[model samples]
Target: MPNTHRLSPVPSTLAVALALALISPLASADDASGTTPKDLDAVVVTASPLKGNTESVATPVDVLYGEDLDKAKAGTLGETVAKLPGVQTTYFGTGVGRPIIRGQEGPRVQVLSGGIGSMDASTVSADHAVSIEPFLADQIEVLKGPATLLFGSGAIGGAVNVVDGRLAESIPDQPLSGRAEVRGNTVNDERTGMFRLDGVNGNWVLHVDGLVRDTDDYDIPGVAILHDHEEGEEHEEAPQPNGTLPNSSVRTKAGAIGATYLGDRGYFGLAGSTYRSNYGIPAGAHVHGEEDHDHDHNGENDHEEHEEGPVRIDMVQNRLDLKAGVYNPASFLESINLRAAWNDYEHVELEGDEIGTRFTNEGYDARLEAVQKTWNGWRGAFGLQFGSTDFSAVGAEAFVPSTVTDTLGLFVLQQKDFGPWKLELGGRYDQVKLKPDDRASTDFSATNLSAAAIWRLSDGFDLRFGLDRSERAPTNEELFAGGTHVATQSIEIGDAALDTEKGVRAEIGAHWHTDRVDLKLAVYQTKFKDFIYLTDTGVEEEGYPVRLWTQDDATFTGAEAEAKIQLADTAAGAWDLRVYGDYVRAKLDGSGLRTVAFDVPHGDHTHGYEVDIAQGGYLPRIAPMRVGADLGWSLGGWRASLGAVRYSKQGDLAQNEEPSAGYTLVDAHVAYRWDRPASSWEVFLDGSNLTDEEARPHTSLLRDYAPLPGRGVAFGIRAYF
Candidate 1:
């Protein structure tokens, strides 16, 4: 069993904008009956400068919060949102999982916190965890498709924005309010607790929040490793771990405090927070092999066996933010908003008691936006954003060189309404510069444009279409990485001569909503001018495989749909049902030429010769088709939900890539609430993987070594005051 002792390691973190209030964009929560809107029509998309709701915006978006968010909350952001259509997770372990949006991962998908880049190194590698904690977020917003016109060219795939309530925009209606929760899991013997408090006095609002989590090695439905299809190829003396995965423990703690001063027409806020985590990487899967020979007393060479110690990561981050905004300005501008943040991040990779490598990143991101008044049905917002980062790594695994990056971007978004037709247009320009300590400085420019239109056919029916062209400057890692990558156990080489990547995407969608029924459907395709990717070179360096980052033309196509139906209120309670499905296909437009050459010993050492061949165009790690259903019900002080999702077997073939079998996951949740004059109390229980199926996602680098948790139950109690 994992230690249940509670410890506070630091004081840090965010003010939040809690979002749980509906089913989909289609319906709104009924306060009197305590029912939620399960559809997508009414939730506001706060990330947009225009401040438009889901239904009012031309982009496809979804917001999760309220009781729905409560039930969906998990240890990692990717797992928390994986059930959503067109979304998947790249799992390194229980401690590391990054969201993969619409067949895109790594730098292509941007993860934001409170409208700003997280400033963490999650994008640098798969083993690095995202800095944002889902337990502290009041609401989460997911945007699908190219979001470059508003955010940046890096967000060509899409973006996930977490609203941490670290700063208060206005004085709360109530004098004081807060919530607290404590939950535990069985599969990993996990324990977690969190709390958030908000208080208002005069024109000032104050906020504070914190969380702690600890878990041991997680149990698996079966053996951790699958047997090899081709037998007798390897030594069978080593035994495989069964029932539980080793070196998979985790411990985390985080905290933050913030306050905002309110004026008659403006507000200013300052906040600070910190986060720390120590997580173990699963053993056996990622191996570092070295041969050692000892000279015997008689001068004979004796070979000895070597074993590697368990690996773990210790990470810490501290951040400070400033926000100032004024509404109803005297000029043509209706509002002015300014946001800025500075952070220092560092993480150390430990091999047993010794430090193997350490990474450090210090950076700041700042932005300013001006909103224009509505004139002749025209509304818009102009934005200016600036950012800089200094990153470096020390020790044996410093695959990427030290570099400093700076960026400046200017963007504009405009919307016009005419009768039942709404048209939206946006454009952005950015200049990015990167200077490496050992390489010459390089600069690149990016241009992005998007156009969309919505036709309101009826009171609750609409059609939406969008088209975009986005360009991206290469990142430092993609251009200069060289040496060993510990996470994937490979020698990664980067090409500095790579050019800017360009993508053109087009999508069409339809939405229908009635008094009790809501539906949404959409499809999209993207063509890349120079799609950059990493591929194995069929070469070896220091006992590790070699992978090279290169570029090629490619195509990606995908579709997604979701529906929610509100049944009539019954004697038991009000019920709602939601069903969703999504699929994506990604392939290189054509094959690429590859070469293999290595020296071999034929009695005497024989010189190697180069052999060139064509490689397959298949893309690796694309998510499989998925379908799921969720049922929700609520009465006065009680709420309940049950859900299941099916992942189809992925047979898509990429050169040297293994196929992943699919599995079904079943989960259920139930909670009861009772209110008092000064506080409210609730107790809840959640069951996951009740069927105990051994499930592994193709997107996981450790898929063969780590399956998801087996049958497990989590129960908790929460208090709101």
Candidate 2:
């Protein structure tokens, strides 16, 4: 394997390893097979279509497990994920946030649950929140970089997979298990109620989950953050009962169900989900023109120019999954497997009178995978997939013009162990078809390939290298849409002759772990040809921003680092600490036109850190670099935890640049449980932004419109039955 020692900071790497080696004498002399429960186990994530340990995968993967979720006191999938590296959100306020990966926003990113696309309008606009709740998730996986193959052509940038219990139905011999939870937040008067159930017995197992949330308009720390034009605003009509309101109430309901059958050889399952949302939509990002003060008569007739209620969207979708595996559980062929799923989504926006526009997408995906026993110390997998989608929209501003697309892909991956070293290589080929309704059809084909290798030189030292090439086609929205979206008020125009986007990325990393610390560093670069961008010409249509979606050739490259240390390990109580951060420089290669996404007149960089307490603590968004300490005690049948996060303001941005200011949000969490696990229940008292810190998320879409919600307190109960 290529030497990746260059990825790390020489001194820190050596110091951490030596410290751990020194402390090894105090640790129990356990076998190298990782037989102790106290040792950290490698997490299984869905970065590759198949399951792979995080440490073994060449690509960068960030995971948020159960304890991590509790620390954040997060309500939605987007809220919890915003804390990970290379992940941010375009917030419509504190209540509505959507994940943005490496500056790539909108439809280019896909959100999934149990490997199937999340059937919601999250991608339709920035103001719409994802229908899936984070509370029910066992873990949230963020896959960064060209992860489009197993997902779809849409994920040119990357994807988020929310792992819930719905897929656990495939497991046999497990009894029905379920949990219930309720929470309330002070910031927006937000209250949430949710429940989840799972079961597996003999030949049949089932899973179901649901959630509902209601809240009033959120409160900002100061005067509502308003554009210069709307600050001293004057209106012709009278206002409603809600304070400073324009239809900004929040309400949502979602439910999912799945069933699986296990036979002597393989298993097949079916899953379906329905999400309904009727929530408040905030005003546009920009409020133009000066405030006119004629009081009652000023601009009374300009009704078309002013939006009355928050933009409302309703989305409904259905999905089905089928799988079959053969060859019982052997040393290698855990069994050959095949899986398929079909999803249909409908999205619509509503104003006072007219249903602005409607979009419907029907998609189907299927894949077959096989695992072979070791051949010369090497094990491998070969897989094939076929997927197709049809989309259409109705109204004056139709973005998706009734198009059908199909893709066929095949791939092979092999892993081998050479003493303490391991190697993995994979390659895939894809053929894509695009047929527009009554338009010139386009048939395009491309090839994708990846290779990675890992070397374990010593007990605490590891080196890894990876390279991949990928391609992506434009979505129906990018190829046909032409209209003014109320949220950002950007006049969007699509191109019919746009070509496929292609690129290659290479990365190298060094990882070391010992008793005192665990540290990792990685560097990567990507070159793109025929890249796509939506360019803003500093123009507007009737006060609405205008931009054209076009293609360009460009390049982006950056580096990242993560580290964790055991500051103090003691018998009375252990004090363990962790820290993680990354810095990225993304820009256009030629003709600095700011055409590439997130690329602008100025270069951009994002960084943050978390100092986790041993017993437990809070993990807020932008969780300032903190110094926290906690204690955990267990006596025979009882256990408890208490901790705090001393958050500090990092920095702030100008009005037009980003919405955020320095502030501290203090928070604490306490929970208790019994030894009779199955019948025991725990209640948690959680406080967030405890300092009542009123701040804004720099990545929020509404940064210019309002501050982050004030302190929120939620009491929740978790019961397993």
Candidate 3:
């Protein structure tokens, strides 16, 4: 590992490390074996049809399972993995958070459930929450770069695949096995409970799982809204909510049931699941005037008897899925896998006790994959995927018009090995069509090609390289939106003449491992011909600023590194140290025509009138540089770890973006386990924000109003049989 020590007056890597360590406790220790939880690198990368582990695949991947997964689990999927290198999460109060990969978010990053789309409206807006529950996942895989060749063109940023194992592929070894857990948190008076049961009956396998989580408004180190420190300017006194964030509570319930038929040559399975949540939007984050409350009631137009109050979203989703596989059905074929899912989702925003707006969606996704037998040292897979969605909104906040979208895709993957080296190549094509209400129907086509190579330098080291050319078609909201959105308090305008985004990326990685040490590093760069983004126009309509969806040439460059060393082993036990750091630089390219420039924000102002210029410009909400380290020790049934990370102050501002301050977070945890012949029990204590620092994420749209939870501790117990 490189040295990061520095003086107090200087900006140093250690500063970054210290800040990261302070944010939250990462999941890295394991009790399964004497070895650390880093062993997940050897697990299969299910997102890929190649069925290769992270160490064998050319693509950069991260996997967390077993004991590591138990410790990392959080209320939202994004929060569960925010500590990973090169990954961050977007926060919108206590309930909403979506994963951001290399500064790419929204539709650019895909969230998948068992190799398929999560089939939710999360990508439609920042205020929406992801439907997939992290507490139920069996394993979570993160593809850290362009995954267009394996997933879809929209995955130019990357993909997060949660493998819940709802539909089993094989029978269990024991007659019955399962796990249960219950936990409580101090910051929010949280109570959460979850359980899973898997059983075998003759030639059939059964599975059932469920979870419930509830929390009150959480505590904060200071006032909920920090106007004084904003832009580093002093502000006059104003009424501000203190200590606890108002209207920031959350409640959720989710469950699933599945069964599989075991056969000699093939297997088939089905699953059904439901997710429901009611969460509040922070006080200052959402503001609607009395005029906006008049709704269509009892065949009347704009009823006006409603009273003003806080805003909350009630969401629910019902889904069904099918999976089937055939092994050696053909003489020259290896296997065939088929999967499909259908979802019905709806959400309503409430004003006081009255309904203000409602959104609904119906969607289905299906895929068929076939693996071919190896011929002359070459092997590959072919796949066909199709999906459709009908989405609509009603009432005051219906900014985007209702629309129907359909997609069809075809892809192929091939690879061959020669001695100590492996070469892989892939290609994909997709066709997308959109039909908007009272608008012309539009169609788009996208193609992607990729190549990768892995060379085993020695028994303990490996090097890999990858290159790809990808394209992404615009979504309906990006092409036709034309009204105000209450959640974001912005007037959005879309462009119908927008073109497909094209990008070329190159990445290189290296890994070295030994019994007592492991180290990995990767560097990547991508150039986009037409990068689409929402820019503040500096124009206002009824107190809300107008944001336009536009595109321009852009560039993204980043690097990530992680290391682990077994520092010592004595009569007391073994001690280990882990450290990681990452950063990404995103900016509009100077090669393109000059883009708009604004006078920019100061003291709560968004921007001034827009202007034009020809120069480099920073992208907004990109996570600042981070570096962190953790030390762990174990003796008998007791295990413990403590760590902190430093997040640098993000001064790279978009024309209208706000500047965020720097801060560090500290966290620690301790767990004890006891084993029996047929059962095991474990109890843990998790602590976060030990310093109670006032920190706001740069990636949050409500950073000026909502802060992270204050210092708190959580206690939990788990049982497995």
Query: Quick one: RMSD of model 3?
Result: 6.6
Best by lDDT: 3
Give stretches of model 2 more than 4 Å off: 1-38, 46-50, 94-96, 119-121, 169-174, 228-248, 285-300, 304-307, 328-334, 352-354, 396-402, 569-572, 592-666
Q: What TM-score would each prediction reach against the true structure?
A: 0.90, 0.80, 0.90
RMSD of candidates 1 onward, in order:
8.7, 9.1, 6.6
Compared with the true structure, model 1 gives a TM-score of 0.90
**Stretches of candidate 1 above 4 Å error?**
1-41, 227-231, 291-306, 592-616
| Candidate 2 lDDT, 548-599, residue by residue in tens | 5666665555554555555554555455544444434344455322322221
Clashes of 1: 31
Query: Candidate 3 regions off by >4 Å?
Result: 1-41, 228-238, 289-307, 591-615
Q: Which is the better candidate, 2 or 3, if ranked by lDDT?
A: 3
C-alpha positional error of residue 719 in candidate 1 after TM-score superposition, expressed in Å: 1.6
Determine which window of 10 residues in candidate 1 has minimal summed lDDT: 8-17
Local error of candidate 1 at residue 359 (angstroms): 0.8
Q: Determine which window of 10 residues in candidate 3 has minimal summed lDDT.
A: 1-10
Candidate 2's clash total is 4
